[model samples]
Structures are given as structure tokens and as C-alpha cells.
Target: NLNGNDLAATVGRVQLAKLESIIAGRRRVAARIARGLADCDGLDIGHEPEGAESVYWFLRIAVAEGAFSLSKVEIAAAVSAEGIPVNPTYRHLPAEAEWFRERKVFPPSDYPWGLPDYAGDRDAVYPCDNAVAAVESHFILSIHESWSDADVDDAVAALRKVADAYRA
Candidate 1:
């Protein structure tokens, strides 16, 4: 039986020691950007739920439905073009992955899509899929533990610029 890999274990131990500081840095950067964007419009900044605290690794933002004419992909592309590390993190199933492709089974006994009779509504599937809905609506901005306040400001500024330019 494999217990664990020694090197991986060692690295995990080291990272665990620094975990608190790492989380703090992430939260600090996220909070700064949150404050900067508080009064801003046309975009919805990521937020924590009532009791949950987020150590935001990638500060996620959702472009409001009517806030801009651009789609999520376009918004992500624009943000990336601005030199900020931003990406749309989610990809819808089947359309984005071959494993989910129609009528493709790895083994005859097991169809990954399951029996056709069990298949649900295809048209309504994407919107109802949580992963699809999330990716369709939001883009993620990478944040680092070492980022300065100016870095946070600059990132937020670029986002605001894109939002304003694309605003409906």
C-alpha cells in the first residue's frame, strides 16, 4: 500500500507552516480591491457569503447581465489583453470536453453519458448546470500573496476601464 510520497509530504508540511500568512496576504489583497470597487458600477465584485470568509486566490468578478454588451469570453479576453492575469475559469460540459461528447463511450459496458433514455433536457441542461452557469457568468483574476496595494489598484482600474468601455 502507498502511504504517501516523501517529497510531497515535506512540501505540504512547509506550506502548512506558511498557510496562515499565505491566507492573510490573499485576503488583504482581495479586501483592498473590494474596497476600491465598492462604489464602482457595471460589475459585480466577488463577495463572501454571510458566515464564510474567503482567502480569495483568484478574485472572481461577474459582469452584470445588462452592464455590458460583451460576453464573458470577450470580457476575459479584454482583461487579459490589458496585461492583467484574468481568465474565465469554468468550461461547460460536453461542448468543452470530449469525455462528455455525444455517443462516445470508452467502454461498451459503461456509457459515460449513461443510457439515452436517462438523458435529461439538453437545451435546458447548460443553464441548469451549476458549473456552466458559474463559468458563463464570471471571470477570475489571479491574485498573489506578494502583491502590493498599487498592484491591486491597477488591476481594479483595468477592470473598470474595460467595464466602462463595454458598458451598455
Candidate 2:
């Protein structure tokens, strides 16, 4: 797929040269934030798997329904109000997507994949109750290599504040 722009190519090359260092910086910041929130209940912060290393594209947290009095939606708002760049990673798609706004049902010839001759039900429901619930409870934190230690600390503090306010 054609995805690059000529101007971006030049900048990308420069960034590529320092990619390893940038990744390291992000990891450091992520680790610090994780450690800061290690004791907090109800929050499941993202972490690197067994032997794999990540570039920290984005930081995410899962809210445990048993531990938190507030919902993921409420936590996101509380954190956002604290001036952090955190947002709910999950949301209801049919309510948010423009395509779904116009077409309430999915199936035979209703979407792009639906063909004219397809003998399928037009109002078929996609079974994904678990997936929908998971997405609705994930909170994403915006992180980057450019952020300073203070920034990470601030994010940690914001999370703690929200957790304290809504402990179950």
C-alpha cells in the first residue's frame, strides 16, 4: 500500500537513525509510570510479555470491574480532567462510526463486503459480546519518547487520583 509522503520520508529517515534510542527512552518512561502505579488497585497496566520487547506505541490500562467503583468511562474523564492525555481505549462502535450511524444492521449487501447475490440475512448480529466489553474497559495513555520524567510522574499521579476517587 502507498502510505508514505515525500516530506515524511526525509523526516522518517532521521527518526529511523535514532529509533533505538527513542525506543529506550519510551521504555524507561513506561517502566517508571508502571512502578509508580504498581501498588494501585483496580488498574491493570500494560507490560512487556515474557521475552518480547515493545517500542511503547501506546500505554494502556484495563480497569477491573471488581476493584473499581467507577466505570472505565468515568475513570477516563477523571484522568482527562487532571490534564493528562489519557482516553478510553474502548467504545461502542455502532454508536460512534459514521457508517453504522446510517446502517443499523449488518449483513447481506448492507456493508461493503455484502454482495448483491449473497443469500445471507441482512440483520444478522455479529457475536462479540466479550470483545465489546473488553474494549469498553480499556484506557489508553498517550506516551512518547519526547516526554520528560516529570511528564511520566504527572501521568502516574493522575491515575492514582482517579483510582482513589473510585475505589470499590
User: TM-score winner among the candidates?
Assistant: 1
Candidate 2 stretches greater than 4 Å from native: 90-133
Residue lDDT tens for model 1, 1-168: 157799889988999999999999998998888777776676766646799998887788877777788887798899889889988764546655544444445755335456576576543333347656666778888999899988888898988889889988
Clashing pairs in 1: none
Give each model's whole-structure lDDT.
0.77, 0.78
Model 1 spans > 4 angstroms off = 1-4, 92-131
Residues 1-168 of candidate 2: C-alpha lDDT, one tens digit per residue: 159898889888898899999999888988888888889988867645699877777787778876777778788889999998887874656644645544535643356336677676655556667666767668888898888888888989989989988898
Residue 77's lDDT in candidate 2 = 84
**Weakest 10 consecutive residues, lDDT, candidate 1?**
121-130
Clashes within 3 Å, all models in order: 0, 1
- To one decimal, what is the Cα RMSD in angstroms of model 2 from the true structure? 4.6
Residue 73, candidate 2: C-alpha displacement in angstroms: 0.8
lDDT of 2 at 6: 88
